[model samples]
Target chain A: MKALVWHGKEDIRYDTVSDPAIEHPRDAIIKVTSCAICGSDLHLFHNLVPAMLPGDIMGHETMGEVVEVGSDAKGSLKKGDRVVIPFTIQCGECDQCRRGNFSVCERTNRKKALGDKAFGHATAGLFGYTHLTGGYPGGQAEYLRVPFADTTHIKVPGGIDDEKLLFLSDIQPGDTVAVWGCGPVGQMTIRSAILLGAEQVIAIDHLPERLSMAAAAGAITIDFMQESVVDRLNALTDGKGPHKCIDAVGTESHVDFGQPDTVLDRAKQMLMAENDRPHVLREMIYVCRPGGVISIIGVYLGLVDKIPMGQAMNKGLTFRMAQAHVPRWTGDLLRRIEDGQIDPSFVITHKVDLSKGPEMYATFRDKADGCVKVMLQP
Target chain B: MPLTNVTGVARSEGDPRVQRKGPSSLTGPDRLARALGWFSVGLGLAELAAPGRLARALGLDDKEGLIRAYGARELASAVPTLSIDKPIGLAARIGGDALDLATLAPALHRDNPKRHNAAIAAALVAGITLLDIAAFKGVKAAHRRDGGAARDYSDRSGLPRGAAASRGLARKDFDIPPDYRAEGTVADAIPALPS
Candidate 1:
């Protein structure tokens, strides 16, 4: 099978790898139909997140048809079922899953010890993520072996495409979302917010093309390069800020301001003095309303320096963050797509074969050629 | 060891034949302790693999060897926590936490170049140590409740024949079909279905 393999910092290769087979009773084999390069993938591409060995398969966002199912998986999933695989692998029977905190499912993370050591707790296994989570082979390949298939993958109904349902795992309805970073996830978040009945959506980014795309999705776009984000958001929300602030940009957030802290963060990041540049997180804290929910879908690996916790606590803010629990939202999102509530394909600016993964990763990471999202057809 | 003839059937938690051992399988604190055990292992490996990188990230690059040594200690602490069924391993972790704090005390000084980063790292370690203590207390309470008879099953073999043998039960084996069912015609079948 042809797949994207991670070699090192800024290096991804399209290589032929062995086809995946069902290794567990709850596993299923899927023939991938569509996959997308995620912004979080750039973290791996740049070698920011540790534990990524050479030849680890890369990619998480995917939809496909089930070609095989283990006996235990037959109870819920069947061969020939079209499904959307979530990034987080969950065993629905775990205590966390029962409580709807599927992203931290206790049973799925094979490298639980490592995850616990790094993050204070083991995260649920994530596809294509490094060994911090279980090093599950990713979906950016011709075929994928999905573990905990009965509970992890959502069955998409007929007459709906993968693009329309892909973003359902990230966004929810009734959220006044303020998204930072107008990348692929940011754009989809904009569309998903609107579809989910968010009264107002604020999209922040420096890129003209991405802001324009956000505007097209009925969001109020803020160019961080041109204006002060905190001021704009305050003025727009009558000094209360949005109800929910989404950090779509993760650890590698670009800082448009020349503030000393921002400069230090960037310099430290460059010199490997720090693993993350949390400019967006700080801005979100400054811009979020009192009692607002800060939802972080962004991928942050290590400890961040100097977050404004005092202000967050004094203002009574709620912080919720995790790798998206894809299955939790996939079923409903698929239904929404089938009902014509959203068309997620609008975010795709580049569509190429699996062989172009290497070049496309660079293009996407650099935000070159107005590329917002790249869809890889394997 | 196989104690029943039913090979493929999923074992229910309520099954009386299966003896409950180790940490309470479903309690919040037990789960947390297990997770902490894993975390210690993971962090230890990272420290051992690239002490220089870990030092740099923590703004203590000058103490690379110390970081590597701490990683070794972490790995040592993690094994007992992960492998042992007793609360003693968690207690050891609390001791390890104190050592870490003492090691990090120098980095907290105002004169340190990366004092802010070091402080953050220390705060994180402190928070984890608190969790370790909480988990330790929970495990201790559970241990007392179980009358200190919670057998350490960590060293048990692939099959548990001793318990069944003591009860005069004969082990039975049965053939179970592998779960995977492959369908080569899925793509063709999908296209043939009516939209």
Candidate 2:
């Protein structure tokens, strides 16, 4: 099987690897049909996520056909079934899963102790993520072994294309969502927000191409480089700011100008003293309206420095953030896709074979050639 | 007597009553115990493979021996649970969890340099302990309900009922023609469908 294997910082190799097999009874094997490079993958590419080992497969956003099913998974999945495997692996029977918090599932994280030591708690196993989650070999390969398949994958309805149903793993309707960083997730967040009937969607980014993509998705774009993001957001929403703000940019946020804290954060990051540069988080806190919700779809690993918690507290803000519990939203999102509400494929700027993964990672990370999302076909 | 459908949906195709005997004659909690059995094996391997690294990562480099001993215990606990269909192995796991908590207690002291790491590790162990106890109780309850019927298959459904029923939607709702290329430029792959 060919896969995008992580070697080190900025070193991803499209290499031949061992084919995945069903390791557990509840596992299923999926021959990947479509996989996309995500902004968070850059975290691994840049060596920001600590527990990432050499030769770890990269990629999470994917959909495929079930090539094989284990005994336990046979109840919900079968060979030849087309399914969208969520990045977060969950055993649906767990207490957390019963409550729809699949990202905190107890049974999925095989390396719970590492997570416990790092984040004070173990998160659910995330495909292709670092050891902080379970180092489940990711979906960037030709075939992926999905654990807890009965609960982890959502069967995609036949008429709906992968393009339309891909973003269903994230984003819900009627959320007055404001997304920061117009990367792939951010662009999907924009499109999903519009489809979900969000009254308003504000997109913040410095890139021209990404902002244009957000505008194409019916969101109000803000070029953070040219203007004060806080001021623009306030002015756009009649001084109230957006009802919900999303930090689509995670730990690897970049700031061009040398603001004191951001400069210090950059210095710390360069010195290997801090793993996260939380500029987006701080900005979201400052720009979001009082009592507004802050939803983070961005990936934050290890410790984050200098969050404005006092202000967040004073404003009575509600924070909701996690790795998308892909299964939780898959059903409704697929239904929406079938209903012809939104098309997620609009975000894909480049599509290449699995072999182009190395080059595409750099292209997406560098925001080169107007690339917003790159879909890899194996 | 057992359901053998591809989707595993035929709950006892031959004898519906047998489905009620519970998964593998083991209760729901016992299944959880079996899961923990595998978890112990994974954890044990990590500990045994690199005790010093694990110890340092946990801020307890000085306790490498203790960590290795705990690893050995985890390996020991995993054996009976994996080999037998009894609840006693799960019960032993609960006991081992208690010992683990006791061992982790010292690291929770405010004065300890590694208190934060120790606290997190202890909390994790405590959580595992609670789960072990819950599985034990579940197994016992199932045993009482069935009057000790020794079944060969588990009764619990692996997938949610709603999700299972909707599984056919993939084949029913949309179809990607065999020749359809999902790759290349997004504009070329999926042209604007008539709105």
Worst 10 residues of 1 chain A by lDDT: A167-176
Off by over 4 Å in 2: A170-176, A258-260, B1-195
Q: Show the lowest summed lDDT stretch of 10 residues, model 2 chain A.
A: A167-176
Per-model clash counts, in order, read 8, 12
Q: For residues A222-323, what per-residue lDDT tens digits would candidate 2 score against the true structure?
A: 887688888888887788677778888888786455445676675566556787889988988887766667788888876778899998988767777777
The residue-by-residue lDDT of candidate 1 on A8-40, one tens digit each, is 655577777767878888999999998989888
Which pairs, if any, clash in model 1?
Answer: A71-B179, A113-B38, A113-B39, A114-B42, A116-B39, A117-B39, B1-B159, B1-B160
Model 1 C-alpha lDDT per residue in residues B1-195, reported as the tens digit of each score: 111122221212211121211111134565677789889989889889999987876667688998898888887677556532426568878998998888788888887888888898899999999999999888666434221122221221111222122121110111111221112223124325587
lDDT of each: 0.71, 0.70
TM-score of chain A of 1: 0.93
- CA-based DockQ, model 1: 0.01
